[model samples]
Target: MNGDWLIRGRDGRLSVYQLSGDAVLCRSERGRGGAWTAPRTVGGEQKLHPVLGIGQGIDGYAHLVSWRPMTNGESGLVHSAHFRPHLGALDWNPVGHPRGQGRRTGAPAVAVDAQGRAHVFVPGEDGTVSLLAQKEKGGWEPWRELKGSSVQDCLAAATGESGRVELYATVPDGILHWRQQEPGAQPVLQEALQTQVRPGTLYALATSADSTTVFYTDVSGDLCAWRPGDEPAVVVASAGPGPVSAVRCDIDGHDCTLLAQRSASGRVAFAAYPTELESAGAWWTESGPQLSLDATVSLTTDDNGRVVAATSSPSTGQLLLTARKDEPGLALEAWRQV
Candidate 1:
């Protein structure tokens, strides 16, 4: 794989490991990106939960979100840090705790618009969704509720040439809800549907490249996909015993592709649905390398079709970061670093 992606994970102990990378270099106590620098403690005294978000800002810098358990059992507090573009260092300017909102925490969600500003989505204690956007002057804007009711989960998608952002969240009641914010305009809900996706409930949400389709799962453990244009929801994969996480990638604009992994095993699997051509059926047979890794895994991608996947192995206590590219023969096995 020519394109390699990576992540840095800390287990709340004193050690921080740079995920698999091509650089093959390690330094002492590094945080905020560096060959090695001192790791900055952001999540306070508690163990930093992995339910955070990491992505590139419009300015081409890496940004991070780390949350900690708060006073209320239902709500958690979050913090933000921006890494200088391509500089192995993190900028700690707008740092602090989420305020003015009742204690609320769920899966942390993030999105960066055409501008470099970052937007973070958290479920509020009131059962409504809230948002936090970065300010030019340095400081987090007050939390703004984006939607009402508890969100099942959130997956962000950047759409159009302007790079407008849309956050897709599934409601506990089984409705897939979405909201889009274009720089200066007000954030509004797009649509909601009963969408009998899965019975077990949604564990994650991922969008296609164009932000047109939304893929989700139900409590019954089935994988289903729904888009604005598609009339009825389609089940892409049936349920397994435990929870399953899905990541959608645009193999090509002419087709739709998905990669899903089980929570317990950390084994990754793939599914494809073609639009330009007629396939065997609506859902293609599941295929691809079955990854057997030690750590629980999370997946992300870059613009160049490169994937960044992280696995924190409970067995070895090591966080493994791997990158795979959808090349001609098979997913290229390019090892960047470990």
Candidate 2:
């Protein structure tokens, strides 16, 4: 899955969503410190792409979006929302083609505003980014185009603590950005940034109420972090060729950022640093046995406020999860396959 595979609900329970055939399967923790339930299919079957985009709102609803093959040889985006923890998700709702009949060329990215409205961003074949957003009261507005060119598929979206949404995408030259001037307003295009990054590796994390930090692998296989208005990107650490997953948590009474990625050797590598303080440095530590290269890692804080990391077993397809130990620093428990 290209998007989020692990999600923490408002009730402190965690749910794991994975792609199985054309359907989306989910397994949730029964309760805090409880065993995870068996994998059960949630969203109905469809001709879905390998990508899955998940965004959660302050109301604890998880919005899901993916592309399905259309009859006209184009791709259409479908959506579903998960509200209750144990209950099943809503049926897949068609968001239609971003350009009416035009095809979606890349994976869709989702971000939920502070009001719990979902905004879906899709890239069209013409290199333009289209947005289909949920209205405040209910319903959805017509698809609108956000002007851009040569926009690559590495689209990232994050809603700031102020309830405004920000978007970033990779262009041939550098990076394109869009931000909402205020909550519930449309995102206006900002100045394009000059930086070379690998496509499909963009990930955004809202660091504060008004600021967001974006992380991605550079062309040289080094992980970097850049916030708006930052002149040069800060190199975080050397990483593999895949996307990275990160979450902010308190470590040893200090606010820190934890990152995980699949290394070139196929093992899960982890690193932690003081949040927004990359100059302090970080070191990559391998955790868990090596799996398939396609296997992705996800991170979230558990009910007890401990950092948890999860991935799927390539051979058994079982959900493998581990949590940070109660000790000091970034120690973790052994991998538990459920």
Candidate 3:
């Protein structure tokens, strides 16, 4: 029910994961043109936190991560699950706390490299960033702390065209960035960039093979985008105080980026603009009915390349979805409950 609840598989099928009670439940499409199955439990025999971290690798598998609270009441442990479209999820595996101590302070953010190794990043209660990564041959390296301080729980990670992974975290003053020196290498901290970012509103989209642009709501509730080293962050539109979800797709043979978020008035808002051209401007269009102020919205491209947006109904808890119609401009089909 939190974090990114929607994902597209390598097979072009889409899957939605949500938190139900202490277990994680999933409803998935049979295939590109198939039907959706009923919701079923995919994780959580041990009690789990509501937050879920999901990342997809090049190999077409979705990696799920969550926190498992210990019975003794000490800091909980981190656990992970893996799933493919046809094959169901594997048993949840324990990924002990970073450095083997202290529960992660915020929802974990995961990024899988070109080699298909998943790297998990979590912010510590002490305001440090910790990383637990998969080894090439199979297995995990010890959890290590990446250089950071005064870090907020909201974090973002993505793999760029160079096949290296990059990470971003918000601090009291601005944002912190880190990137792999090379593919599969340990991520090294880059220069800290100063900007006023709202906590829990960071999202990263890989704009090109070598560059990734991070989007977030500023403290003033304006949506902004910044590609490290290219330019200062540009305001794209005004939005509510929540995380924004975006995906890049071809609209009428033109490359475009589509964004979705919960509006200040509680409706899901959609926007479209030329990719990397924030200065061109975008208009926010509210769609669907009002939702909980904290409800999360996710966007992904279907197999046919149509943009799909999804969010859970706060009142009924049913899944609601809408897709871009195959027409000129950014027209959408009616919202449908799944």
Q: lDDT per model, in order?
A: 0.45, 0.83, 0.80
- Tell me the number of clashing residue pairs for each predicted model: 29, 0, 2
Query: Candidate 1, after superposition: displacement of residue 234 in Å?
Result: 2.6
Highest TM-score scorer: 2
Tens digits of per-residue lDDT, candidate 1, 1-338, equal: 00011333221111222322211111222333223343334322344444545544445544555454445553345444434322333322333344553343555566566666677766544456667777756666776766556554443433323565555665655554555655634357776766544432333332434545455566555555556545535455542433334444556454344444443233444344553121333432322233345333455454454544554443343444444556642253532223
Ten-residue region with minimum lDDT total, candidate 1:
19-28
What C-alpha lDDT, on a 0 to 100 scale, does residue 158 get in candidate 3? 84
**Ten-residue stretch with the least lDDT total in model 3:** 74-83
Off by over 4 Å in 1: 1-50, 69-76, 84-104, 136-138, 150-162, 197-210, 238-256, 263-266, 275-294, 298-310, 320-327, 331-337
The alpha-carbon deviation from the true structure for residue 1 of candidate 3, after best TM-score superposition, in angstroms, is 7.0
Error of 3 at 117 (Å): 0.4
Model 3 CA deviation exceeding 4 Å by range? 1-3, 313-315
Candidate 2 Cα errors over 4 Å, as ranges: 313-316
Residue 67 of model 3, lDDT score: 81
Arrange candidates by TM-score, highest first: which order?
2, 3, 1
Backbone clashes (count) for model 3: 2
Ranked candidates, highest lDDT first? 2, 3, 1
The sequence of per-residue lDDT tens digits that candidate 3 reaches over residues 1-338 is 32356888877888888776677878888767467888877753666777778887777678788887765655554555555665568767887887575544678888888888989988888898889899988889888899879998889988787778999989989888899988777899987778898878888888886788888788777788888886655656566777888889998898888888888898988888888888888889899888875467899888788888888743455788888887898888888778
lDDT of 2 by residue, 1-338 (tens): 54567988878889988877676788898987688888876776666876788888988889999888777778778999999767888888888887676565788888999889999988777788989899999889888899788898779998887888889999988888899997777799988888789888888888876688888887877788888877545556556888899999999999898999888888899999888888888888999887776688899997678999998743457677899999997888998787
Mind sharing the TM-score for model 2?
0.96
